[model samples]
Target: MFETMALMPQNFSLPDAIWRLLISTGLLLLAIVILRTLTARFIRRHVTSSELRGRLLMNFRNGFLLLGLLGLALIWGDQIRSLALSIVAIAVAFVVATKELILCVSGAILKSGAGSFNLGDRIQVKDFRGDVIDQTLLATTVLEVGPGKTSHQRTGRMIVIPNALFLSEPVINESFTDHWDFHVFTVPFKREDDWHTAQKALLAAANRHCKPYLESVRTYMTKVGVSRGLEVPSVDPRVTIQVPVASEIHLTVRLPAKPRQRSYIEQAILSEVFADTDYSTEKP
Candidate 1:
């Protein structure tokens, strides 16, 4: 339909310009369709570094397509004198369509390169922390790894968090500072309970698996903290128990660990308590 608008020269015929505009528009659409499908397929099939690169490329391609469309828009402008204005209008469209994406990509690169969260780290990016499975420019994807694991597991769903969180929001990398964060589970016992004995058994289990790693982590934590002028973070194992609830006392243990290992350690300690605790005593 567009003729004079498609050409730089006024002498161009209406039919010739229309043909050129349609031809260019057709090619643009074809590229868009092909690139969308191919890139989606590649990202789906890959993981880790390779997948990250592919998604990053896909984000760049989106910007490129916006430029291509602007090219066509200019080619079909109503008046040759309005060429600069058409270009400016198209530039705004490019920003509107791609600004957020560009921000996300920028944040993703900063975070990934800084080693913010490695695969399997328990990180809550904008409140979606679990075990990180894959991180890409567009999203930080994780498999929820807790009591919620089984419930969400049936659906085989992965949590996809926008990477822009690295820029604007606080990231709670549970794996970075604490390998483990614990919740207390309490079953009531008599006031005359051997709580110390019960607590020991739980601590013993944790010490067995968690103690050896302490020697190495202690030095690392201390050196890193001191260099950064941070308090030499306590590396010794810790256990806190409280009897705030009637008939039950709650015990909690926390240890430094890799993010991926939190669930396993929790299960281990719980199994130890279930096996060793005596039921006759009632907590008051």
Candidate 2:
């Protein structure tokens, strides 16, 4: 029987080809499942870092898919050369179609490995400023915070930003180190007003409101300075006067503040300054 079959024609009918294709597909799926189970078990046993595990799992998935394709090609026999060419063409097409998506994914991987920012960090990218709520391979989701007239309050909007933007634009991670951030606001006064009293009052308000952050900010700044060789400026509340207009005096108050509490601190300072009869008195 074996000799007779070998001597017979090599041509296969449509039904036979279809049946073989189905059988190959089923075997490929079973192999994929088994390989995935073994790979996962090995990775779980060996991989300690969560990030590394995720990366390894992704690589395993890709490898398994390639292996499955190769197995199918082998099972199909005579179509091996055409199968390889088709695989290359498919891969090229996929890359071309998902170029930006691939870049975004790469950016996410780089960002994660570099530890640039993490979930719950308040970051500003271009015109968007919000707390990062979610991170995926292609995009980062941020809970939208105030942009106009709202300060740090959430605006009930979710912004999905492509991770690729991290490679292209600078990210201002306000919550990168801690909950403290440098806050600065300008207060305008009439030139004839008691500018000196106003300045002292503003400084006092800043000190009062920002006292809690002083020690932590100093420690953080000191570490940053020592490690980066950057100057560790004073964390004490500072007041600088600017005369942008002839008849007006601008007092810029710089202090450490929790990003979310900036607006409240500013309000408190303004109220304190305004309520002071000494500073509010005209220069008559």
Candidate 3:
């Protein structure tokens, strides 16, 4: 007991040090539970704005929890500081062991400050493209989709992207405006499938989603241009049905991208097309 106590994390008894470590961990967890309870009950109930609530929750809940753990580690493993040089050496070794984690976290921190695009923004990093689902200090997640501007199907796969990608790769954000357009087409080979009719219908559908965005974007652009000296495009929302490949008719829709819900617009167009053709349909 004497020797063991002398060799404890803080040069205290191993048993006692472990007990305190466990206690500290437990308290930290308890603090989180209580913080969440209060945030949901008091903060959320009183603060209704989602953005404000999120900021507050992140500040108090996450910040305090981390602080509590740090404090406890200091207490329970207080003696570790005696070996500060050793600790640095071990940390360097661990960094080598988890190099990817270090790089990812560093990249994430850099991107986090840039406001990391937004939740509804569409960003492409490396070869992957999708809507931004979530962001953290280590990675960005995206809901996978087909290539090009149009998404034909939901990949149903959640992609965790390393934040480091943002530094070196190009990121594109679509739907910066309220107006967005989408298109879908019926296969040409389907029986009695009127490709022309499908094209017309798809165009009409694209226009429905496009007109509002176009008008709003135009209005917004005129206002911004006068004040901020920005140039806006004169293109109207449009859809074109073309046979991209021999097997499939590609209905390409051009419209201002909506802030987030590009996938919804695509699915809605596909759903409408299915009502007429029902060829190779998938749920949105």
Error of 3 at 264 (Å): 4.5
The candidate maximizing lDDT is 2
TM-scores for all candidates: the values are: 0.52, 0.60, 0.46
Clash list (residue pairs), candidate 2:
none
Candidate 2 structure lDDT: 0.85
RMSD (Cα, Å) for all candidates, in order, is 19.5, 15.3, 20.6
Give the top-scoring candidate (TM-score): 2
For candidate 2, the per-residue lDDT at 128 reads 88
lDDT winner between 1 and 3, please give it.
Answer: 1
Question: Per-residue lDDT of 1-284 in model 1, one digit per residue for the tens?
Answer: 37656766768557876788788778887887787678766766665587687767778688667867786677676545577788999999998999889888998998977878787666665546576888788888887644442211213457888887788887766555553333323334455677677677767777787787877777777777787888876655566777776766666666666544555666767787777567446455
lDDT of each residue in 1-284, candidate 2, tens digit only = 99999987798557878787888789789979998999999999999999999999999999998988778777776677777899999999999999999989988988898888888888888988889999999999999888653367788999999999888888878774565678788888888888898899889888888787689888887897798888888889999999999999999999887767777888888898788566645555
Error of 1 at 52 (Å): 62
> Which order, best to worst by TM-score?
2, 1, 3
